[model samples]
Target chain A: MERLWNTHIIEVGFDKIVEFFYRMSEVADKLRQEGLYFRYGPERLPEIIRIPERGTLRVKYGFPIFQKYGVCMDVTNVEQALIAEEAGATSVMVLDKLPYDVRSSGGIARMASINRIREVMDNVTIPVMAKVRIGHYMEARILEALGIDMIDESEVLTPADEERHINKWLFKVPFVNGARNLGEALRRIYEGASMIRTKGEAGTGNVAEAVKHMRTLMNEVMVLTFMSPEDRMKKAREYGVPYELVDLVSHLRRLPVVNFAAGGIATPADAALMMWLGADGVFVGSGIFKSQDPHIRAEAIVLATSMWWSPDIVLEAQSMIDEAKSMMGIDIRKLKPEELLQVRGV
Target chain B: MKVGILAYQGGVDEHRYMVVEACKELSISCEVVNVVEKHSASNIDALIIPGGESTTILKLMKRFGVDEVIRKSIENGLPVMGTCAGAILLAKRVKDLKTGRVLQGTLETLDMLVIRNFYGRQRESFEIDLDIQVLGEKPFRGIFIRSPAIVEVGQGVEVMARYGESYVLVRQGKVFASTFHPELSGDTRLHKYFIEFVKR
Candidate 1:
């Protein structure tokens, strides 16, 4: 019955996080203020948790993972996750969009890709994640069935058979969505998306202005309907809420949904800003990959992520982090890595 | 400020958003209020009852407190806007949604044929361009979310707006009503129109 349900947008009064929580809790006893929505504490974004030099222990409130020196990485390979861990990433977002026909390739199919992700999960002690598309609830459920931590419910990609494919709210799995604006983001949360990532207007390398725009918009909307920032955080904390994507979805009751911010994060300062703007964690992509000092920047990101949430403990890494050397050395023309080509946005 | 939106409980978000958006676009402060609240009438500068389950709204509003405040507000000339269930509330004689008893509420404010739940069920919700006579310019893109139809208009009632065969929008003094949700109708011209009417 839940699979084919499509919701027509309706306007209600101010989004009532508490009222919604109460209503939903009344319906589902397990959620009785249980708030089984987000991964709390410092281990939230375990992808970058193991960065060797950049791993700091600073923590921020509300975001999924804002530690003193938070560590996170985007990886197609397990080894890269290790490197990110060594550099200081708590969690690694696995973003190799599996080929539409994984069976066509002898190496691995999309389903098998999850197996490989599982291997990475096995190798790492921290939480790991993979991406899925809207309406692809089956694959997402299967991913959750395999015990992979969180699924990035990406909007940019979908092999959905039809628009009638309902939201993942019906499933027992945790779902996340990447949204550029607040209204839609909150809607996704209500629909059972556990995680929320910043849309970041992908493909465009421009970061500063776009990220700031997102933060400003969210700030206004959140403040308009709910308690002040400090009070909201305290309440969320009192409820044992992570105020992360997964938590917001589980707590959906016409309230301000909590989610980690992602996309267009290009600097440690940007990572810091996401925390400042109420993000639970930061997904650093172009910022880490395109930095002049890749290793240093990556380390800086991990450090900044952790410290951004805390007033104390600024990043002062002792070990020399590898600045991601110019990728010009890797002969992209020589090697036929289609994944790299996709990143080129050609 | 405790802005009462008729939680007709069918599809409330659209109307809630329209008013919120209008206030946002116009920089006026507002919030969705329960018309059922006893305190809402005196507390709010205005009221909007969105398009929704008329039977549910009528019964619930009365069970709650919307019926009283509405009459009190109209008597005091406080601005009250009804779209669909809201429109029904402004009617002098509403066919008691359940018993079909044509009972009278305080509303003799507008002259119009008010039909209850004219747009059948949920499957009938639709969208169409409306030529709102009051705007005197561009048409209002009416997004009818389970809308009722205004079957007729009385003499004093200015047929301010219509979509094809149905009177989608209308107004009367401090009491403005529409069969379709003008608040949900994407265009702020109606909200702006209400604001202008209220201000004047």
Candidate 2:
């Protein structure tokens, strides 16, 4: 009764590159078995395909690590993780230093200790994610080896590379990258990120930056909906991503991967605001543990996030904790341009 | 017509968005039923169980006493649709993947047995196009994310759609269940179908 509908089809060109790699590796294995070297001369080598500096690519694997409306809390130890789990957090993001402490303490930030990560993973039934320095493939590999559920190539950590970021397509574990704009999101997607988080000036507790970033990304997507195919192709060329991916964004009217809001989210209201703005969820870092009532705040954020559509539920969540006992708000404007975590990658 | 989406837990937003889109297309009224305790069969023309963690949803459903209410309402001819984890809760029997332990608390509205995560874990999740007869010649892209699979179907249950012989979408009178997420597919045909089903 129906003709073929082509409007919803999505073509991810990077998938072809991944398939090519698989083929090359298989061919190399065959050659090695015959005691031969299969080598392509520079002239015969496959032309290097250029990816747009900031275009979204199709994600290969999607492990539902976090449930919809679930909160992924940032924890530094097993106890906080367990607390988060008990409070209804779907997942926990293990970190060596909470963003607020990182800003105040000002030092070389790095990945959390493997031993601590293992302890947290051992205790929590929920998924455990950890952070690695941006562009640090080795750290990502180590996290993967330790069997981390997900890895955040975070801007919160001191970036390891200046020119390039970690190539996530090579890993078995999924990666979550932070973005402040559509181009940055697209570029990270091209790099094979399974999840995207708004890098909203971490440790601020203001929620303004998170709102701005989310609106900016969504607005950019909204603009794409009205553009002509030729204009979209032109935009794709400008963004440096495959036209198919751009087209997919146009059709879906949202990012293909799970998009979360992070960086400055603090209260139940803050979490609810992000959900209303179309974030898949919210990541509370210094927000919960930094507050006076970690347990109540954690539980409240989870409830507020899940029942975001209800203002009465949000009000109840807000009433559960005191705002004065929460983490001191930092004016994002006061932070120098170099101190901003969102500006690290791209 | 007023459609109620069960909003106790997981993937609630996606369902709300898709259902709202479907309503707009059909020009019908819609509301998200968060307080399951307060929801009555008379007020809701139909209900949608959104995807999420089945265990958590089951526990909450029990706590709020929504489980008994929903099960009874469905028995009384209340139209309902369950997707992903929702499908597992709607099945007659649910078994744990590794422990082989049988867990129950499902609505048992659909006359079938489902194995949680039968296809595989989250990393193994995938999307495939399927030829659903009722939806016409256009194939529906089913998004399977750690979804359950129907292992057995009882009498009176009609298998409406499948992905390569695997039972993914099934219907039993007023009850509908799908192993994949049609809401996230950015296609409202399934939602439209449900709304049309409600109108009838």
Candidate 3:
């Protein structure tokens, strides 16, 4: 055994053998903790794994989408996806079941089927995004391999892990994550989320939670602007995010990434309200699909989001949809604690 | 001077911000307006077509009757600049890179042939620094997001920059177009150059 050890060390060198064993231990440790590890050859790891320079991913992915499309509509099939594109949506999010359906039919919600996503992608000329359950890195990988424009490590879908999230930095495709406040936004940005959206009570068709979350986030940012450097550092620690990010937020008076309001935005008025409250954009899920006229409602919401600053245009947009045709809203307060999707990833 | 940003869709704010910054640097008084309708399009001293979804912007422009106004303004020698999708709109010919067919309904102001999504999808988007003599000795960092590429330019068009064999920036008469977004780069040189053209 001693002779064999000496021969092996001589052939591969002590440093290389030690590194090999150390890497193997890491893999074993990861397997034990997470139940799986994507194995790649050591030489090719650097090329496969990427750490985005600060703000690069956001500039390349998030900013373009935010600037181009003030509204991202959710769709379940090829027809809805086409309607979304036709209605002038800048982007569309694909789902196996719309948020309303997810809320109605209680089950383990995962990423949409690959074929379904492909069908949507094939049908639409606009950018196609889809959601993967929180911490489901394998599903993220599949989406990335499928050439998805963006991935949402979303709370709308059932989380795969209770306490962890997919390390977004590992993927080439930009990710959008849901955050309820400044801390969550910064944390997701630190974790390499290129975009951040408010985690309102999705599928409820009630914009109150969405409004509350946006107000909280913006108000927190306002508070940060008044803090001293030392107080800011303390706040950063309290938020469990990097002080640098906190500093950036304080100086910029906004989240460094593109922030969109999502969850329970059901009407043109609701969409305009979020935009007026300072969302770069918005995401409508059940709001459009569950409405009386999905096509007209979608166009109205798009117009409202884009022209939120102009009251007359917003009024025009509001008149395009009928309130009676809107989705029946749920009182978020009535939902049990376990039924909340917003609290899942948080 | 008043500048109109074709604000129906896409990076409208970014261009407005950059143009304002450029004006400040040049000590020129400029008012930026969102050209949502025909009147706004007609009243501008200069126009900017921002980087966005070309089809969406085209649809909105036609819907609001801003497309004809813009076409007429350019015909009357209005200094205009377009980036990415904006560049696609200005091109005389636009070909879809995926389908290898001509895309119709662009403003067709600039004398160039642009291929849409020449660099593939979002995952294939990139950023790079280019040497443009017009912008002086410094390398301008170009942010390209699913950017188009200028495959051909007419006799009147002057190529300003190139990435590989394709033209990324071009100019003909008073029209300027770039396949990569200059507004996102936070560099004001391109904006300044266009401002100078407008000034002239």
Candidate 4:
């Protein structure tokens, strides 16, 4: 409480702080007039470029998807990518797993597999994403440096590293992580994962049981969140009632990405329902082509998922189903779900 | 009379568009060349280092073994005009962020600062009117896209234009630099100036 002020402290101290603020203000003003600031670093950009968003909505959404989606088509054929593309599958997953081998193999074999994926990318117009074994963030960066659009941080296969999966946030390129369940999805999202995919019990190729399993889980999920079909419609209705409230899409866009209904998508309706219940998209394995109606059902499922709410979209989807079925010699709609026992715990 | 546009990265397309149109009106050939890997020095009579990620493109240039090739080409006295970050790379001295001090990027190619992304960020990008001294009479339009500021310049650097206290344009013999992006503005005067410089 002593008030003796025969000191140089205020004059020396506050004056410099005041001068510092004034100089900062001047620098800011200069930047306003001059467009240049003091250096931060050379390796990083002083700014991002703001070009117009040129692509369509699907394309924009798909940009990060295919750029980073993992578990690529294990096949050598590039045309096989067309199946995923036409299904509006954002990307074809390239798995490094030895497709036939119960035993995974050598480094040269992995590189050869990668080269084959590169060939597929060259033949296609869309961006190509690649995979890195978990905890392999350095390798992921190398892939990005090679002009790869994305990386899949999937747990489906990693070379049994001693450490935890490499954190995706450390890399700049978009990364898609495999979410085995809802908890994992949220965990990865918290860990700065930009995208997520449901882990389909892959490679077994049993179509119907998988579809039913996913449907049951999605149904259970509807009860747990505000993303239920009825609730989403209700929210849309509430927004429409105000009609003047802006930022409907902006808010929707920020919701943690839940694209790709995973595990089991046995039928087209299941695909539509998944989209209805707030999934950003769906992943089908054994669901479409492996089903009895290989072509028609796949097209219908794709169409329904792509254009869930709009009837005009439904018709277009139907036509797509028709065309795909005729072209591929498989009526996808005719494929019935495979039956299986419900494990008591599952 | 085909003009080569260094298309390694950044706003290469914008400059390519500007130069190509300038060439079309002047009946000169202009091509956007991926100068990092795919070009020989003799492929074009003159070069325009377009505004862009200067470091990334320069990294590619070094990785692809073209940095010295470019330095030698500039030394041989080819007319070169660099805009924004492009201007920075073409400068004889640049602020090397690694050492927190100035270092040489070019072989005294342009006696200018060519500060990298002197502008703060994309939101800071803008267009401004300039009182350019070299154009000789009229006010010229300028677009600055994440442009670098010329904090200092050597004696050979001619301060060609000023926007308030900041030097917006500078020229040193065949080399010229502007902190603003003239290509993005769609103004032909800068291109015309470079063409005239090349002709001289």
Q: TM-score winner among the candidates?
A: 3
Scored by DockQ, the top model is 3
Q: For candidate 3, give the lDDT of residue B58.
A: 77
| Two-way lDDT contest, 1 vs 2, winner | 2
Using TM-score as the measure, name the better of candidate 1 and candidate 2.
2
**Stronger candidate by DockQ (2 vs 3):** 3
- The CAPRI category of model 4 is incorrect
Per-residue CA lDDT of candidate 3, range B62-138, in tens?
77778888899899999999999899889889887765667688898888889887877777776667878899988
Candidate 3: where are CA atoms >4 Å away?
A: A1-69, B99-103
Separate DockQ for every predicted complex: 0.02, 0.14, 0.17, 0.02
Find the 10 residues in a row with the least total lDDT in model 1 chain B.
B117-126
- Candidate RMSDs in Å, in order, are 23.9, 8.7, 12.0, 19.9
Using lDDT, give the best candidate's number. Answer: 3
| Chain A accuracy of model 2 expressed as TM-score | 0.83
Model 3 residue B69 lDDT score: 85
lDDT of 1 by residue, B1-200 (tens): 44565542333445566667767777777666644356655667677766443443454456446577667777787787887666776776555322244534434556666654355322234445566667776655555443456767776676777666777667666777876555433467787667656656
Query: TM-score for chain A of every candidate model?
Result: 0.59, 0.83, 0.83, 0.53
lDDT score for residue A256 of model 4: 30
Q: Over the stretch A266-313, how does candidate 1's per-residue lDDT look in tens digits? A: 566666666666554567654555445665667666555544533342
Alpha carbon lDDT of residue B2, candidate 4?
Answer: 54
Worst 10 residues of 3 chain A by lDDT: A1-10
Candidate lDDT (C-alpha), each: 0.51, 0.76, 0.79, 0.49
> Mind giving the per-residue lDDT tens digits that candidate 2 earns over A209-317?
9999989988888889899999999989988777867877776677767788898999998998888887877899999999999998998898787767678868988
